[model samples]
Target: MADPNWLDERELTAWKQFLSTGAAINRLVDQQLKRDAGLSHQQYEVLARLAEAPEGRLRMTDLAGAAVTSKSGLTYQVGQLEKAGLVRRCGCAGDERGIVAALTEAGWQKLREAAPEHAALVRDLFVDGMSRKDFAAFAAGLAALHDRLNPPAI
Candidate 1:
């Protein structure tokens, strides 16, 4: 078929580069998290989100949103963490139907221990490679793209 509103050479090249670099970055981050924390990147993210909450606890629905994962996927991952004694599920006091996922003491300790190494890896593999000005520009552009793609829920 003939090209119709197809990407020109420059656009195609840029798209390919963006995809390749993004994949590489994802792999590096996941590997670093696994190596330094005995945690997958997703698991680390879940713990970090919980840690930032007021009481290191969030509703399972909120946790799933924060993790940007499906409910079933979040349930499976949280199950693994629960099995590892990294977090526990508690019933929400105000909502009998709601369950909260809270980071366990062991989870906090593991995250604390892995913090430095994780930061170092992120810096060395990603942030350090970008100049401050360029990084800011990239972040702004990414934020715009994300907002455009995902508007807030009504």
Candidate 2:
């Protein structure tokens, strides 16, 4: 016999809306960046992560984790950024085998210029449509789910 946990109509609608919203948000952000700054959404994420680092630098492995991408995928994306002169690889001061990825001045400038438009896109796509209280509850719920799935390291 088959399991009986199939989604009801409301659940199905919510699931489909989630998927569609996610895809549409991605497409909007990607298209905006590509049109205005010539960067893909993934590339923008790499830059954002580097910009978040102290001294605008992070170890490649840390960058991969922060960007939620595989090591090989991060390497490929970093290589592309390097070729575009947006980021640079520097030797780790203490570890011979570790390398730091640093966002260049050009990268910082690009991010600054793109930020306003990117933020507007986010607002237009989602934030403006939601109630602040509902959004907060939604974020908190997702955080709880994430903590449950990936518990604190102990």
Candidate 3:
């Protein structure tokens, strides 16, 4: 009898493809962002998240949640950004202990400069490779997996 715990051939293939494709995409995106924008992928993500928040700022905890990073990891990245003058950290008014990360004008300018080329790279490397129908199905599958892994807090 076959081992029930092992992936079947199709499942194995899909898993391998998912790992390899994700790694390859991450490497390429990281390289491109570093080369063109002088920012790491994580830093860019932080800036983007802050830019989306009210007043271009968010509490550190909320920002960590939005960025899917640990508090320590976010703190490290925020430190780096602060050193570069791309982000500023301030005490939250409502909570003395709470910290907020606010994107500086420099950060906004950096994101604006980086976004167009970043979008083009994404489209070229990933989006353009798949047909619209296939891309939609792929996106739906990923979204379903995300939802399953991160159920809403009731």
> TM-scores for all candidates?
0.90, 0.89, 0.95
Worst 10 residues of 2 by lDDT: 121-130
Comparing candidate 1 with candidate 3, which one achieves the higher TM-score? 3
Please provide, for model 3 over 1-154, each residue's C-alpha lDDT reduced to its tens digit, 9 standing for 90 to 100.
Answer: 8867989899999999999998999899999999999999899999999999999999999999999899999999999999999999999998989999999999999999999998999999899999999999989998999999999999
RMSD of model 3, in Å?
1.9
Q: Give the least accurate 10-residue stretch of model 1, judged by summed lDDT.
A: 119-128
Candidates ranked by TM-score: 3, 1, 2
RMSD to native for every prediction?
2.1, 1.9, 1.9
lDDT of each: 0.90, 0.91, 0.95
Candidate 2's displacement at residue 109, Å, is 0.9
Candidate 2 regions with alpha-carbon error over 4 angstroms: 1-4
Which regions in candidate 1 have their CA more than 4 angstroms from the true location?
1-4
Off by over 4 Å in 3: 1-4
Best-to-worst ranking by lDDT:
3, 2, 1
lDDT (Cα, tens digit) per residue for candidate 2, span 102-146: 999998998899888988998888787779998888789889988
The residue-level lDDT of candidate 2 at 66 comes to 88
Judged by lDDT against the true structure, how good is candidate 3?
A: 0.95
How many Å off is the CA of 104 in candidate 2?
0.9
